[model samples]
Target: MQDYSEKVQVIHNEKFGRHLVAQLDIEAGDTLVEERPLLVAPHWECGQMKCAKCLQESYVMCRSCKMFPLCMDCQGHDDFECQFFASGGPGGYICKDLLVKNYGVCALMKFLLLLEDPSTRKDCERLLETPINLDDYRDGDGMWQEHEELAVRPLMASGLLMSLTQAQSLTADDLHAYCIRIDSYSFEVTARDGDTLKGVFVCGSLPHHCVPNTVVALDEEFNLKLYAAVDLKSGEVIYNSYTNPLMGTSQRQHQLRLTRRLECSCSRCLDPTECGTNMSSVKCRECPDGYALCELSSGGDWRCSKCSAILPAADVHELLAELGGALVEAKGELQAFESLLAQYKTLLHPNHFLMLDIKQNIASILRATALMNCMDQPSKKLLARRVELCSELLPICRAVVPGISKLYAIALFEYLLSLIELVELQFSEGELNKKEYATHLKTGRLVAKEAMDLLRFEPENSSEGYLVERLAMELERIESDIAKYGR
Candidate 1:
């Protein structure tokens, strides 16, 4: 295996399914993981019909069974007969097409064919030892649609035919064919317990579990980390978290049943309980009664556990979205995504479904800036949307929006200004005592400090680093005045 410690890495472990354990221990605000995508699959092609031979569902047309495609490599496979074409043609597995199309036939198949001949399987095996950026065939677009699967027969026949009264000698075309027919498989290796190095375990190697102890969450490094969500004994199996942490019982149960194929009978799923609902409203004495429990609630939203009263817009969705970005980009698409510029042009429009999505977004961008798209000088509508959304997304907005983006920076400024104004009014109205006024001013100072955090130094003066600094100093001055006059 390739040693990647030079790039990025962290300690991780796996254990047998003897006793169950929690995935990881996390503080209320501690970050558990971070990851970067080695390869990504496009979202649009994931669910599409894929060629069984190659796994490509896009671009390349399968040759023999023209219906299912191998893109280009296997496009030549048609010279020979094969299944997976289409109805009334050849037919095979649909999903494998994308995988086959891009990577070509399995690397192992090619390696074996090379060894069989005086060709080189050693070279192939050497390549296999390292991590290669290969697209997945399981999802349609995961693999590039343009590559052709490799083949092998010709190379083996090459030397034999040359000695005889062969009309033709083995050529590049024949060897290429041999390369495509090779079959390959995938496996993963990790320490069985915290410290023992076991070999690799193949796919579906372990039996399925409803709720296993070892929780698998991807750390920021994009590698899966097995955590002890709860403590475990020496002999235990590690499991991964299957759904969102804050998701309610019914939703969680439904997800497990639908995706993991297990009926979750966990205590939380069985109990008609609501989590975090009444916690918000009960704080302000808004809802005296505790929030109602639901075997199946629509969603937790802002409903507090202490009080069922709806919490005024806290922009929790935005908070979750920002946090979720780390994971979403890490696992990648299982298929790669379309080019960003192309995707925006294709998917986003005023009356399109995404517009509906934009409208339906529970996370108000008005409260926070976008993490990815909020950079650069966007179109009018996008800019307006940022202004509308990040106006409310005070703390997280700067993190999401680009410092150089005019609207995003302006939004931060306005957000800070509004806060400063709100607290300044506290002094004007005498509703706030001297201490209260000072505290409010301090908050304004913090907001200004956040603006500086948003500033980034680029090759040259990237953006408004000093401007934010000036604003922070201004907030400090306001705090000083509040200290003197209010007393």
Candidate 2:
């Protein structure tokens, strides 16, 4: 494995409960480092046998799809439950690699390299065919602890392990000694057998800042690395692009409630400072000669902060038009589309027609980012949320747009993926309902059909559009199976 000087440290701070910091001044386009695999497990019918989530009896489910095993008894326990809301069905892919052999942290770091990205081309073009694990290699729990004494397996097994220096720099300890996050940042690729990696897409690497110092993109080396778009002094916290550190208590609280698991009381979160400008909402059109409009107060009449005059609600329509046009054109603004959303609130209520339009744009960006980032391969909550978002948007899409828009189509397609997850979840929970499973499978097929139609115009819908397009074939296959076997 390539060795470079990387930094890791643990520290304590009030802003972040318990934090970790890593100081590696990655040259302009250098790839961010990878992490040491905490543990390695056997894959398939090798030495060990169990599910990734439930740790129950695991068997090779499918050699082609590479997913979960069908379990009528334990659907709720697996990590990536099928997306269907129904209980049990053979329609979902089963788990084959419980221990993630032949894959490890290298794969994790590689997948995470894509984050907050927009295009699916960047994702699909990459070669990620999995490897087979050697039967002779099997390590028990002590194997993970052996990392301190052994160099990671051949670079060929995975790739360069992430520098441990980075991990130490980014964390701190309390009296209890358990690692609480100084900031939420860490890679999620667990080590599989042969020291291979399973579960790509690193998570928990960024500390929070109001304005991010870095943007998400793949590095020149084809590894996912954090970049410093702007300069920063030592001791300043690093951050990712998509958030408003400055907002009101209620607003920040709500977002945190949904995204992060904490309720924030940070300075920028509660009180408006910086430029004495309102952030929680868009400025109203009361009176600012040159300043843009936004929500002036937490509540009440709308007006501009720069000039204290009142903005009439009627003119908001014009502002909405401007906001929509700018939002559509901002090719490089994936992380800060909120800036685009600000103008619309001046005219419409939180859920007004124009405001909904802005939300649709925001969701579209988020969906694209999620796929390129390989979110489903990692975070459980993110996968579930992605499933939920697609489900929520479907009805709205059918009613609002005549046919599904590109985003809507992608959302629908993603929802079908979600149904598969639902099946996985239900099956793992041991509550698989064949009837419900069939229902969800059917629903997913319908939605997949709609999304395929939309892809004609909006190809940027999801990362797996082509995979979803192939759903029709899978559906026909499933129908034939049902007819032949009488399931």
User: Candidate 1's error at 189, in angstroms?
Assistant: 20
Model 2: weakest 10-residue lDDT segment is 174-183
Listed in order, each prediction's TM-score against the native is 0.31, 0.31
- TM-score, model 1 to reference: 0.31
Task: Please tell me which predicted candidate would have the highest TM-score against the true structure.
Answer: 2
Best candidate (score: lDDT): 2
- lDDT of all predictions, in order shown? 0.35, 0.39
Assess the local accuracy of residue 403 in candidate 1 as a C-alpha lDDT between 0 and 100. Answer: 24
Model 2 lDDT per residue over 63-139, tens place? 32244333335444322122211232223322224224422222222222221122322321221111112121223
**Which runs of model 1 end up more than 4 angstroms from their true locations?**
1-221, 224-239, 275-365, 368-434, 441-487
